[model samples]
Structures are given as C-alpha cells and as structure tokens.
Target: MTFLKKHKNDILLILAVLILAGGFWLYSSFAMDKGGEAVISVDGKELCRLPLGVDTTYTIGEGEHFNSLVISGGEAWMADASCPDHICVNSGKVSLEGQSIVCLPNKTIVSIVGGEDSGLDGVAG
Candidate 1:
C-alpha cells in the first residue's frame, strides 16, 4: 500500500507512455493505405516496378546472385535471397509507402512508393 502510493505517478506515467506508443503503432498500421508500386533496384539503378494491388513473383538476378521477390495482398517481401546474411529474406512484408527491403551483399533494394492524395477532388467527372 505504501509502495503504491509512493510510486503511483511513475507507474501511471509508464502506462501512459505504453498506451500512446501502442496507439501510434495501431494507427500507422491500419490508417495508412497500401502504396502504389514496388520499385526494385540494383546498385542504385531501378530494375523494375510492380503494382502493390497486383500479385506477382520475380526472380531478381542470375546464377548465385538472385533474390526471389513476391508481391501479394498489397505487400512485398523477399521470399529468398543469395545474400550472405539472408537479412532480406527475413525482412517480412513491406506495404506502407517508402518501406524497403535491402540486400547489401546482392546490392538489391525493393522499395514501396506512392499513397499521396495528389490534391485532386475525390469525385470524378
């Protein structure tokens, strides 16, 4: 009882922080829509563009230097990669605008782009 009274403010502060963080995470995940394209690149040069709303798979390179890219359910993930660390393959899915999967050893990048409203009226003529 004494401890609770003494540390009440600190405990409340921690809970408030946790709640705010979780709210931010939930908002970012659900409120933001899927991006326009998955723009893949190798060594800083664009390799291809894949629409986010479409489902597709791509083998990114040749021989031992390759990454299997999959776009499904409005998200992109590296299904497989030839990079030494395999970090790209484990990167999970990216759907929000500007998210990316980067394979440093393979010099490959898969990035998401779009989701701006473009300042146009919602109603079409």
Candidate 2:
C-alpha cells in the first residue's frame, strides 16, 4: 500500500506520456491531407501539368532520330528512350518531393516538385 501511494503520480505521468505519443503518431499519419497536384518544371518555371486519365509522349530532343518518352497519370517517369543505359526508364513513378526521372542522353529531367500551396515557408507561417 505504501509503495502504491508513493508511485501513483509516476505511473499516471508515464501513462499520459504514452497516450500523447500515440495520438501524435495517428494524427501525422492519417489526419493530414497531403494529396496535391503534380508539377514538372525546369529552372524554377512550370513546364507541364499532368492530371489524371491523361498522358503525353514527349520527344527528348531536336534531331529527326531523337528518342521519345511519355508521362502519364500525374506521374512523369521515363517511359522509353534510346540511351545505352535504361536506368532512368526503370526509375519508376515518383509522387513525392525530390523524386525525379531523368534521361541522361537527352539532358531531360522529369522531377516532382511540391504543389502550389505546399512549401516549407508557407507551412511554417
């Protein structure tokens, strides 16, 4: 009885800490809505806005024999190319920040930047 009396507050405090941690984890994982537009750009300017159910095949260069590629479903990835190494083509769909699909032979980079209203400064403020 004496031990219980002495450590009652400590036990309650530990329980409270655990509950708070679990709540925070749940909120961060599901409560936040992170879905947004997929923007492709070069040098800080917009290039393409790909929406759902629509796709476009892009030629990578100016020459007559230049290779081509396609971006589909708000996911711009390397679809096809003429380069010796198909690394870029196999990079897969990128839907998050700092993700990119690049074709080295054509000097073309298909990267995923954040949505218009989603940025570090905007969120902080």
Compare the candidates by TM-score and give the number of the best one. Answer: 1
Clashes of each: 0, 0
Model 2 C-alpha lDDT per residue in residues 35-54, reported as the tens digit of each score? 23445444455666554224
Worst 10 residues of 1 by lDDT: 116-125
Candidate 1 lDDT over 61-122, as tens digits, reads 98999999998887889998888899998899998876889999999999988733211213
Clash pairs (backbone) in predicted model 1: none
- Candidate 1 accuracy as lDDT: 0.85
TM-score of 2: 0.46
